[model samples]
Target: MRRAFVQAILALFLVEAHPAFAEGPLHVDITQGVASPLLLAIPDISSGAIPEVANGEDAGVALAKVVRADLGSTGFYRFVSVDGHYAAADEVAFAPFARAGAQALVVGRVRLVGNNVLAYDCALYDVFGAHLETSQRILVAAPQWRRAAHKCADMVFAFTTGDPGHFDTRLLVVGQDGERPGLHTRLLSMDYDGANQTVLSQGQELVAMPRYAPGSRKIVFLSFVMLVPQLVLADLDSGQITALKIPPGVPSAPRFSPDGRSIIFSLARDGVADILVIDLQTGGVRQLTNTAGSNTSPGYSPDGAFVVFESDRSGDPQLYVMASDGSGQKRISFGAGAHASPMWSPRGDLIAFTLVENRRLRIGVMKPDGSKERILSDGERDEDPSWAPSGRALMFQRTAAGKALPGVWMTDLSGKLESRINIDPSASEPAWSGRRP
Candidate 1:
């Protein structure tokens, strides 16, 4: 029963909008940053035909709330007050929402089909335009009704912002439990909004720097045994873990290739560390860097044609880019501070990294050629930037000056609208996963 619940089934189908209304030009331009959140009127979804139980309430009401919360968190849409909301029934009266100053409106219905199966239908409308933009129907297991809501929110987001939605994605973070003497560091997994958390590690050993494969259920991370770092691969669905075979060295910052066929990491042996890649299929190892100084934290460009890493070959640690096979090594960061933990954005437009200056670490981004560098966080200590699947925002670890532990915080590309992920116990090193299959 538990296994069946864990493997909850979900299906999505597009539904035709109302014939009377047509699609209109109502969109939120996110490229330039949303100056003001678009006001939306979202009423409780109606229970149509059958009243199903989900999330301790009628599936209609609960799912509507989840959808509203998901859109609100992105700092893109603001929910109209309950007093200003009208019944989101099959027939929507757009005049009321428009009079309430709502630019957009959402309406939905939930019904139960066979045993423990739910069908959620949601529609998005432009209140001012008085037209239906899109609608979708999601069928899911009762326990997985929340996924339906997330999918609905994603549909609305994509229609409004012209970008892929990231609400259905997951995040892997390093969670610390207990204090320094007997601290238990475990690899944790949760939804993008910090829900349905699960411990991926046994908490027996310290886990750090977890990264998800581009579009798979596997992850690679670093684990310490007896204070020695070891590269580990984990199958999230199977709960199986195995140590990766590599050259004799201490491995750190393991990241998957865009194709998920190989992994790139930094291997430290003797007195120096260099970036290396291991082919997961044939178990062949290749070194990408042999510079004078240490090179580490390597990430791949979206096309897998270039690699970005941090190296101190020129003195302070700065970002460098080279061909995927280790040729054409060149410095990309020429700023005043040192850069590390460089991660390429999914859209292939920017590279996010950690900039260390004046004894403080901050999260920043730069173009592929290392142009238009801009800091996105004002926290005292912000580092370990992981780009969102959409490449429009980033998640990083933030620690206040007087704090002992760091928490995960997210910021948009504009450096405005920052929020801390509401998860208990300090967490760090967040890796955002792509959309779930």
Candidate 2:
């Protein structure tokens, strides 16, 4: 079984390196020169008898706010508010929007379907070309009305940018509070915009490096049990926790495989750490790296054929890649500073990482082969980059001068726009989940 597995992995390496086997839509290269933000007009969705939900709020106006916020946060659009502008979709005047320099216009309306259901009709238009781009009618339970707005914004984002939208995603983060001596951290989940925050774990146990399982509601993290680090699997829905049967070692940086059947992490045995993988179903273990120096922060390529990790085998911590089964290990980063926390983009085009130079940390991205490295952020401390599901942006932890608290902030892949996620009780270790079904 081991021999055949190695052979199959070798075959995959050959195929994956070639151009023909590559799949997925081509992503826009945002690293190029800064472009002007697209002018977009978002009129409030007409509230035609749209009854309030349990929250006693105007569902139509709330939905429009969500849509506007989602698009505005992307940093690729300049919003034209609809305060005194058109209210209903039919009242829209394309000529006025075009004259106001709006290239695209989004108009929608919300109405009550029944006592417990709501319907939203959204439409996108090309103002300059005077034509309708797309339209859809979405229905949802009154309590779930936020999702309908997200769906509408996603449609507009996809129609304009030619990429999948990330508005309908959730983020897993470690929520920390209290003073330094008594700091407490807990696992928390919330919408990408910091809404609907849910605490997934109590603060009794120390946890770090929370990662979401691909296409699953489970998360893999490192939890301290009896002062020993153990890899734990957490189900989001049921709040169940199961410890993986890894060898007795200090586990950290656990990330799920693309198939969600296995996890790759670093385990420190004795005084050295190495990368390893464990199959969840069979409790089978496979060692990926056996180097003398510490090898940690293993991240899988989107296709699951290769794994990138940070290792100090070269005397300085740098990025390295090996086959999924721990073959053909080679160093890929040779920059001036040490690099760590390497995260492969979901679109499979670039790798984001943290670079430390002269005692300062910055977030950057480079090609898979470690070329064309470009630092995208300038912060006193910026680390732990987690890619948005669409690979268009990144969320990382930022700590400013005189502010010991670390807060979560996001920036476009180009670093042209940056915004802080407004969540009380400063947070860190943000892991953006894949688009939820």
The per-prediction CA RMSD against the true structure, in angstroms, equals 3.3, 8.5
Using TM-score as the measure, the top candidate is: 1
Q: Point out the worst 10-residue segment of candidate 1 by lDDT.
A: 1-10
- Give each model a TM-score: 0.91, 0.89
Candidate 1 residue-wise lDDT at 407: 90
Pairs of colliding residues, candidate 1: none
- Model 2 TM-score, 2 decimals: 0.89
Global fold similarity of model 1 (TM-score)? 0.91
lDDT of 2 by residue, 1-437 (tens): 01111110000001111121111221222345336677888876546445445265666667888999898888778886434634554567787777777877888777766756676777777787776667777776666677678778877776666667888788888888876412688888888888767777776778789999984378888788777778888776565778888898788999999888899999999999999999999999999999898999999999999999999998889999889999999999999999999999998889999999998889999999999899999998899999988788899989886777788999987786799998788898899998766
Deviation in Å, model 1, residue 408 alpha carbon: 1.2
